[model samples]
Target: MAFLSFGSKRDKIKKMIEEEKFDEILKMAVKDKKALQALIELLDDSNPGIVGDALLLLSNVLEINPNSTRSHITPELFQKLMALMERKNPYVRENAMLLSYKIIKSFPEVASQHRDWIVEGVRRGLTEGNKDQKGFLLMVIGELGLKELRPMVEELVSVEDKVILPFEGKKWVPLGDIAKEVLEKLS
Candidate 1:
């Protein structure tokens, strides 16, 4: 469907998400560039159903078209999502974390320029955030291979709870095993 002609505006937006039409939604999302603002509004909708879908849609769009949404990853979005990490809603925090992770992966140079904010965000999420959120952070850290984050990963290992690496089809394997194997070879 044409980005602009998707149908009743709201339904069209929802349909774009449901159909995983990242390209189309992204095109629409950048048109006027206000769609990003609209998507941000849905992030706080009281309706959990709408909020969850919105977050997922935002995350997916950002992941698929990082360049299109790069501008949306302003300091405001960073601060807002980091604040949402403390919210009672796991879904919100999880999606927010994933969005942050994707942004870091897609734009490592930009992320490096804002290392302090990214590090602080991950630190808070690692300490006070939910288990799932912690897992996401660990995965991001591992993917980035940032030696600077080694201390955080080391600290995580001391906990009785193990952080598992997410694998294909959502299965998880012990992160400790992965780390140990890598460390042994490095040493």
Candidate 2:
């Protein structure tokens, strides 16, 4: 019976994703362990959209309850996230980075174990990422005080391109301004 419910739970979560009922999923994750587990399991789903939704949902869960969320991140799950960071789908990659940043903040030990990968991701994001991605990577470095990335970040200070910051409305801000801001916060 319990085994049967797991499939139903996963199916329900998939339906929610398909319907774009993210708030409902967040509420369920916060209130029901089964729902949360279903979301975690969905992270393994092959569909990039489902994986991206799972990553966003997990990151939101981490934000709401860092302690409880930390327990869900096993070594294997973390490795899966690392792989997702390299995914060609921008949504998946961005959410993977966001989740990784949140995880690094909440679970220092797990992050320290994967520090090299995290730093490399930042390096790659700066080079290959679009405006949003580059901005987020800078935020991660600044918030985490990853001073080792100072030189690489410094090189971006001269870039003149502006990025649309979603949380900051429709205004476009210079990427170099963001880089400068991160540099200031690095120490």
Candidate 3:
């Protein structure tokens, strides 16, 4: 078993991610809080490439070790992610929202603590954000608004702007479907 040494964990983990060594990264990040912190720090780096890789790695890490990461959640981390959501980079925004969903699901306290603020922020994005952002915000809203389905349906059911979400290769997901799904959750 390879142990993750401290101090250089950021560069090492970034390399491992670049090399597509997800299994190793997951093991080390799940076991070492320092490794997790390094990944989190990457989110603040000036390099968008590093930030994207860090977001991907952090989301995957949270999935693999949710129990170990409850203590890692903080208002600052959430604030950074929320800021990332407002950025123009599609990868950055999607991963940030996805990671937020993962963390909220793992710790109900996150949902209770931040759901209203997050939902409202995303709702605001629906009108003010760009195309890609509107789609991501709607998807995140779908996941977060389950308990307030009636209000969510009332507010989002008429949004037919239809953001195009392209997937790998020729695939794509329609944002309208997401809106429909959110309404369905209300039923």
lDDT of each: 0.62, 0.79, 0.70
- TM per model? 0.67, 0.72, 0.75
Best TM-score goes to which candidate?
Answer: 3
- Candidate 1 lDDT score at position 134: 67
Writing each residue's lDDT as its tens digit, candidate 3 over 20-60 gives: 78778778889988888888988987777778878888888
Worst 10 residues of 1 by lDDT: 162-171
Model 2 TM-score is 0.72
Candidate 3 accuracy as lDDT: 0.70
Say which prediction, candidate 1 or candidate 3, comes out ahead on TM-score: 3
Clashing pairs in 1: none
By lDDT, the better pick of 1 and 2 is: 2
Candidates by TM-score, descending order? 3, 2, 1
Query: Residues 1-187, candidate 2, lDDT per residue (tens digit)?
Result: 3445534488899899999999999988877778888888888898999999999998998888776676677767766776776677878887887787678778888767767777886787778877767876787788777789999889889888887543343237788888898888985
User: What RMSD value applies to candidate 3?
Assistant: 4.3
lDDT of 1 by residue, 27-63 (tens): 7775635565567766666665566667666776675
Best by lDDT: 2
